[model samples]
Target: MKTTLSVLVENHPGVLSRVAGLFSRRGFNIDSLAVGTTENPEISRMTIVVDGDEYIVEQVKKQLNKLVDVIKVSKIIPEESVSRELVLIKVDAEPQVRSEIIHIAEIFRANIVDVSRKSMIIELTGDKDKVSAFEELLKPFGIKELVRTGVIAVNRGNKTIKIEEDE
Candidate 1:
């Protein structure tokens, strides 16, 4: 099964390396990882996606909790939370195809961020599936480059797995 893990850690330099090392040592491949600052300056949040058996994933979570710098960890799947990803795609576009691509992007609710005589850059943000669908729609026009910010998630209202002060 595929699982998304939201991890809160100290904003120390080596924390990310340690956490990543844990997964690497366990022979688990991280599918995607995005780390950024949260509201609190002393803390950083990481969203990681991994695919593995349920038992193994659970064990990994337990091991992660053992790390001193790791404040909290939660597995977020589709049923429990809302998840989103952001993507930027650059496509080949000239006078002939520019308008058509813009129309399609509008239908998908994507924004055109940059435009040159021969190419256009689009910004899209949505769930994984929605972003994939948009990419597919633009594939025929010729993609020049693509980049994505992996999944980020939060639990439903009024519910969350937060770090306890003592633990």
Candidate 2:
């Protein structure tokens, strides 16, 4: 099973390193990890995806909570959250294939971010399945390069993650 964890941490140097190190030390492989500052400059949200069983997920959460920098760690339930990933693909676009490539991009509502005589760069943001489908379709055109921003997600409704203050 793939588990997504939403972690809130103090925004400070080395915090990311420590968090990543913790996973490494425990022999846990992170499938995807994206971190960025939140609305509050002092905090950052980390979206980490790991492929493991329920026991492993529980262990990961417990271990993460022990980190002093971690403010809160919650499992992002798939049905309750909206998740997305961004991918950029540079594919061969010979004159004869340019139009076909553009048509493919249009089908997925992907943007043609860059173009040159030999290749075109397509940008798409979607859930994993969408992104993978887009990539598979572009592969026949000869992919020159590919880059992806790991998944980032948030709860679908009014629920939010925040730091708790002691009274």
Candidate 3:
């Protein structure tokens, strides 16, 4: 099973490393990890995706809660949440192919952030499948470089994850 965990921790250095080290020591492989500051300056949220059994997911949560810097850990239910990823790709384009590339980018609603005589850079943001499809379509033109911000997700409205002082 693929489980997504939203972990809130103190905005302190080495926290990410510690959390990652825990996963490494436990033999859990992280599929994607995106960490950034939250609304509060003192806290940061880490959106982590991992493949494991339900039991392992539960164990992972428990271990996270034990960390000193961890504020909270919540498992995200895909159907009840919204997620997105950002991708930037630079494609090798010549005059003849430049028009075709631009057209394809338009079809996907991707932005041509930068362009040159030889290549063009596009920025795209969407769900995992959408991003994957966009990349596959541009593969024929030859990708010069690619970068992505791993999946970031949050539960739908009316619900929010918070830290518990007693935890």
lDDT of 1 at 2: 82
Tens digit of lDDT per residue, candidate 1, span 60-149? 789888999988988886887999999999999989989999999999899999999999999999989999999999999999999999
Candidate No. with top lDDT: 2
Minimal lDDT window, size 10, model 1? 158-167
Off by over 4 Å in 2: none
Instruction: State the lDDT at 70 in candidate 2.
Output: 94
**Alpha-carbon RMSD of each model:** 1.4, 0.7, 1.4
List TM-score per model, in order.
0.94, 0.98, 0.95
Per residue, candidate 2 scores C-alpha lDDT tens digits across 74-153 of 99999999999999999999999999999999999999999999999999999999999999999999999999999999
> How much is the lDDT of residue 159 in candidate 1?
86
Could you tally the backbone clashes for each prediction?
0, 0, 0
After superposing candidate 1 on the true structure, give the runs of residues whose Cα lies further than 4 Å from its correct spot.
none
Arranged by TM-score with the best first, the candidates are 2, 3, 1
Residue 135's lDDT in candidate 3: 95
Error of 1 at 158 (Å): 1.3
* Stronger candidate by TM-score (2 vs 3): 2
How high is the CA lDDT of each candidate model?
0.90, 0.95, 0.94
